[model samples]
Target: MSNNNLIKGSLQTIILKLLEEKDRMYGYEITQKVKELTAGEIKITEGALYPALHKMEAEGLLTTEIQQVDNRVRKYYSLTKSGKAEMSSKMNELHAFIDNLHRILNPAIDPKLNL
Candidate 1:
């Protein structure tokens, strides 16, 4: 499959972490922030992002505010109480997964027990 499949699986965690740090962000802002943070290594598409945002909003994990910016209206998303709690849980899960993946990819061998 595509590398996006890997990003897709972790999209929720990525968004949650970003919102946690930034407090509030608009859709395009979120995408740009991710690209900036990853130094152009990753890009989040509108197709994947909006659906995830909608789903999180439906689940009560996010709250939105609409404001008129210049001539356009922008919707900003911030984490709700539930979202903060979920963010903590998701962060722990992601960390553990990363640690496990790292171990698998770079196995450590004891010199005394070299196989």
Candidate 2:
């Protein structure tokens, strides 16, 4: 599977978790942060990131602020109260999914079998 496909599935969780850690972030900032944190393993393109951000805003999971910096307007995204509440749930879901994937991919060493 392509890295984009894998990242796409967890994009929401990734964005929410990042916002949870930092108070607010702009689009480019989010993209760079992810690259830095993952050591270039993942790259979030504007094509993918903006659509998701707009969707989350429509869903009331995020709010935005426009700021002028370096002679340009930057739209910063921050989690809403509901977004913060949803982060914990999303994180737990992601963790559970990862655990399941790990088990399936490593059945010979499955912890459930004490192997």
Candidate 3:
């Protein structure tokens, strides 16, 4: 599937989970990690990432710190207190979503699934 077809809601979960692990991450790193972790099934573009990040920041779910590296400026994002709290719920929701998708895709293979 093209990257554009990726379920949009998953992006927030990805960002939150990555922050939970990495503590802090810059935009490019987050995109790269998503690509690598998903085996390129997910390709996060700057167009997709930047706006979400900004929105999260605006919503007080994330905080950013700008730094200079090799004469380049980079903004790193980390979870705020609320962001941390939200991460747990987001993780559970993601798990449930994947479970549902798996059921839909391979219902007969799932012993617990009736459909």
Cα deviation of 112, candidate 1, in Å: 16
lDDT of 2 at 58: 95
Q: How far out, in Å, is residue 75 in model 3? A: 1.0
Cand. 2 TM to true fold: 0.90
TM-score of 1: 0.90
Candidate 2 per-residue lDDT, tens place, 35-94, comes to 999888889999999999999999999999999999999999999999999999999998
Candidate 3 local lDDT, 7-98, one digit each (tens): 47678878988999998999989989988987987788898899999999999999999999899998899999999999999998877877
What TM-score fits each model? 0.90, 0.90, 0.84
Query: Model 3 segments beyond 4 Å from truth?
Result: 1-3, 109-115
Q: lDDT value for candidate 3? A: 0.86
Best by lDDT: 2
Instruction: Give the Å shift of residue 110 in candidate 3.
Output: 7.0
lDDT (C-alpha) at residue 51 in model 1:
100
Q: How well does candidate 2 score on lDDT at residue 7? A: 92
RMSD of each: 4.0, 2.2, 2.6
Better of 1 and 2 by lDDT: 2
1 or 3, greater by lDDT: 1
